[model samples]
Structure formats: structure tokens, C-alpha cells
Target: MADKVRVAVLISGRGSNLLALAEHKRRDPDRPYEIVLVASNVPEARGVVLAKRLGLRTWSLSHKGMERRLFDQKLDTVLREHDVELIALAGYMRLLSPEFVERWEGRILNIHPSLLPLHKGLDTHRRALLAGDEYAGCSVHVVTADLDSGPVIAQTRVRILPRDDADSLAARVLEAEHELYPAALERYAHELRGAIGEGREGGSDD
Candidate 1:
């Protein structure tokens, strides 16, 4: 496991995707990453509870009164303490400050519950239904300062059914997210490790 990338998953609610990723790691010994930490702003977040149940190291602090960067700084401290190499934003509701994004640029990934570039912000399933779109899906992408506007790594599309409401569509899309995220994260970790290796090996000796 020395070669595995240390990953930290950030969440603000029930951690369905967190469970999915953890299960994938548990079942796949060859995964190129390991879950090192699970942290949240809400002290009672169900995700934090689930992480503890899964025997993962966990941290939580209420973000109610703290400034965005201040809260993120504390969170960053915990992540650094765990030597986190990659961050997966799984239903993490807070908008990260530009400073935080810069600190982990190209190292954060998020799974947005829309095809993305289609539904950028919240209420995506409802918006997709309202827009009369033919499909709704989830996307795994790089986390940029812009909300849900990062470069997509992979996506899974669910057909928008005629009888679907927001809740129905959301339920199906969430299922897609569970399947899409773990696979995308594993792929991204491998590619990132390879890219770093290439950069190091190809560096000029000055």
C-alpha cells in the first residue's frame, strides 16, 4: 500500500458516494488509492458517523460561524496531518474559497449530479426536468473555483423517463453516481500518479 495515493473524502451529508468508494477500495486490493480521512463541517453529519463505522479516521467541526477560508484552513490542517494526496468532494455542500482550490489544484475531484455544463449548480434534477432535457446524469470532474464547471473526467447518463419527477430522476442519477465516482476516482488516481512519475523521470538535471 506504500504506492497507493492517500485520498481524503469531504462530505456534508449522508455519504452514499463515500460508502461506494470505500466499498470499492475494500473489494479491490489493486486500487491505486486509499481512504485516509473523512472530514465534514457538521459535527453530526451522517457521513462522519458512517466513516467511523467503516473504521476510517474522521474529523468534524461546525462551520456555522467560521469564515469560508477559516473553516477550510482547519479542514486543510486535518487533511495535511493525514498526508492526503487527493480529495474527493462527495456531497460536500460548501463552496470552497479560491485560496483553498489553489492549494489543491488538480488534486480535487467532485461528482456533480448532472451531465454538467447543463446543470451547474443546485436543484439539477428539477432543472433538467423543467428544461425538457432528454437525459439526466452524473459527472465526475476536477474541482475548480467555479462551481461544477471543471473539466469532466467521466459521466454516466440516465435516460429521463416520461413519468419522472425530480425525486425519481434524482434517485436514479444518484445510483449512477455511486457507480461512476469510484471508477473515475481510481482512473484519475492512476493517471495522476503516472503523470507525476513522467514529470519526475523526464526532468532535466540542472
Candidate 2:
């Protein structure tokens, strides 16, 4: 079998989804990818601490004063150094520069708090509640140049209750995110691995 695809996860907050992904990988020995690095823009992020406890390699630097492109360039260097093949964004608050997005292209995925094409930016849960929607959900999608405008890989919907507020709906959506993200990544990685195999096998030696 081919070696597992190398993945890096970026987080800015508690990294609940990161933990879920790590736990899923640990539980399933045959997963198609391995999270080789967990990185964060916040040097003191809790996710960094959690990654350490999980015995995963980590990289972190404060993005406060740095310019966007410059920070992304430095981050790109670290990712390349780790030979990362895929990137998963879990609560990563910063917007990636367009250049950086083009560099990785379809190789990156992000978990959004709401079903995309509906709520593209922040305050998604609140907006859903205000609109009196019947359901709110989380989506895992490929990262593109446009914000939250990527092709969705998968989604998990949480039904909105009669008394649901933004916070309550957010919490339920978060739980769904934890479940959806790991499973989505697992399947996507498997597809990527198969594509690589097909390419190599179909190459002609001229």
C-alpha cells in the first residue's frame, strides 16, 4: 500500500475538531492520511497545547504584527519543511492570502460553521436563528480564493429547536462539525491516494 498522505491542521482556538481528527486517526489504523503537523497563528493557542499532549508535532508563530503575505510565506515554508500534502483549517481565524491559496489550491479544506452559499462569513449561527431557519449545519469544503465559497465536500445538519438561540445552535453545530470533518477528511484522503495511484500507473515511459 502507498504511504499515508501527509496532512497538517491549522487552528486558532480550542481545536475541538483537531482533537476529533486525531482521535479518529488513532482509532483507525488504516486511515489514508496522517496528521504530521498541527500549526497555529496564535503562538499561545490552546490547540497547540492539545496537539503537544497528543504527541503530534507542532509549529506556531504570532501573526499579530506581520503582513499577511509575509506571514503566509513564513507559514508556507514551515509547511513545505514538514512535507505536508494536505491542510485542514479548524477554527483558523485568519484569512489566507490569495497567493497562498493559489499555492495550495485544492489541497486545502476548511470547516465552516454554517452550510455554505447561505452564510459565507461570520455570525452564521446568529443569522440562522434570526432567519428562523428549520436547520443549521456545518460544512467541510475545499479552500478557494473566495471566502467560504469552495466546493463543499460534506455537511451535517442540526435541527433548530423552538427555543434555540445562536449559542445553543452553535454548540450543536460544533458537535456535528467534529463528526463530519474527520469522516470527510478520511474519505477525501482515500480519493486523493487513489488518484495518485492512477496517475502513476497510467504514465507512459517514452
Candidate 3:
């Protein structure tokens, strides 16, 4: 397998995670994998704009165009067209249809604000602050049909100061997301290359 991995990013809003990935790629010009596609349900998604700035291929599809299944089929086609080996979800607000989740399965990953399985959904930073927690964190994990219920790959922890508010905690957690997501993706790409190599060897030897 070639050294650089192919990655596709999916986003609905601000592409913080995508930006993080791009930053990582910039610092390591010799890395084997590079982002090949960026797709967003929102046509004006900032992530798509960011992708274009990075000179990577990008596309936008309206999520309201068809039944969920039809939409996923279109999405699947887009991903395939780009030769995407892995997918990362960044600021995507919609709940992915199960069909699409199953299509990618272990190949998909997402960064969630809270330390997942804890806050599970939105307002994570606020939730943590409201609960009077001393620490807040971000998580990168494999995507499954269950929302934010997949196996975690890595995480970064940030300490919440005594006088911290939601915004402050969120800012720190967002920083963690930046550091964590790219590292998680690198690991995922390395793992995929290994699996592919083994599969090819076994296939040829049979």
C-alpha cells in the first residue's frame, strides 16, 4: 500500500476537526495519507470552504433532497468516487442513517466534545460545567450505528479551572479536539494499511 492514506471529511458546520487534520498534514508533507474529499450536507459549510483553501477536492449535497436511504446512496457514491479509505465527521449535526454507518463501519470516525458515553449528545461543555466537574475532555472514536457509542481510539484531557465557565471549558476542549482527532486518524490510517496488506497477501497466497 502507498504510504499516504486517503481520507474523506464530512461536516455540517464549522470544520474545526478538518482544520486540525489539515494542520497536521501541513506539518508532515511526507505523510502517506492525504485528504481527498470533503463533503457537507450544508452547501455553505465552512469546512467545504476550508477544504478548498487547502486545495483538496470537495462536494456539497443537499440533505433534504430525498428519502434518507436515497440520500445515503448518493453519499456512498460520492465517497466511492473519491477513493476514500476512511471518513471523519466534523461538526456534522445530523444523526447519520444506520445504512451509511454500516457501510463504513470501522472505517468511520468522529470527534465528540464530551468524553462520550457521559454527555452523549449536545451542550457537552455546558453539561460538564453545570455538573461541577473538575475535568473536561474530547474523544475520537470509531463510528457505529449507536450515536457516540463506538469504541474510543484516543482522548485528550483538559483541566477545568475553579472559575471556569462553559465558554472557557469549551475553548479548551476544542483545543483538545484539534490535537486528538488528527492523531486518531493517523492511527486509523496505519491500521487500515496493515489490514489491507494482510488481506492482499492472503488473497494472493490462496
Winning candidate number (TM-score) = 2
TM-score of each predicted structure versus truth = 0.95, 0.96, 0.94
Candidate 1 per-residue lDDT, tens place, 1-206, comes to: 13788899999999999999999999987899999999888779999999999999999899997899998898888999999989999999999999999999999999999998998999999999999999999999999888888899999999999999999999999999999999999999998778777776887888
Candidate 3 C-alpha lDDT tens digits along 1-206 = 64467888899988888888988989997655688899988988877898888898889988885788887788899999888888889887878889999888888889998877778889898899888877789999888998899999998778989988899889888988998888888878888888877776677543
Judging by TM-score, tell me the better candidate of 1 and 3: 1
Which ranges in model 3 have alpha carbons more than 4 Å from their true place? 1-3, 204-206
The runs of at least 3 residues in candidate 2 whose Cα sits more than 4 Å from the true structure, single-residue gaps closed, are 202-206
Model 3: worst 10 consecutive residues (lDDT sum) = 197-206
Cα deviation of 162 in candidate 2 (Å)? 0.9
Score residue 45 of candidate 3 by CA lDDT: 83
lDDT of each: 0.93, 0.93, 0.85
lDDT string for model 2 (59-117, tens) is: 99999989999999999999999999899999999999999999999899999999877
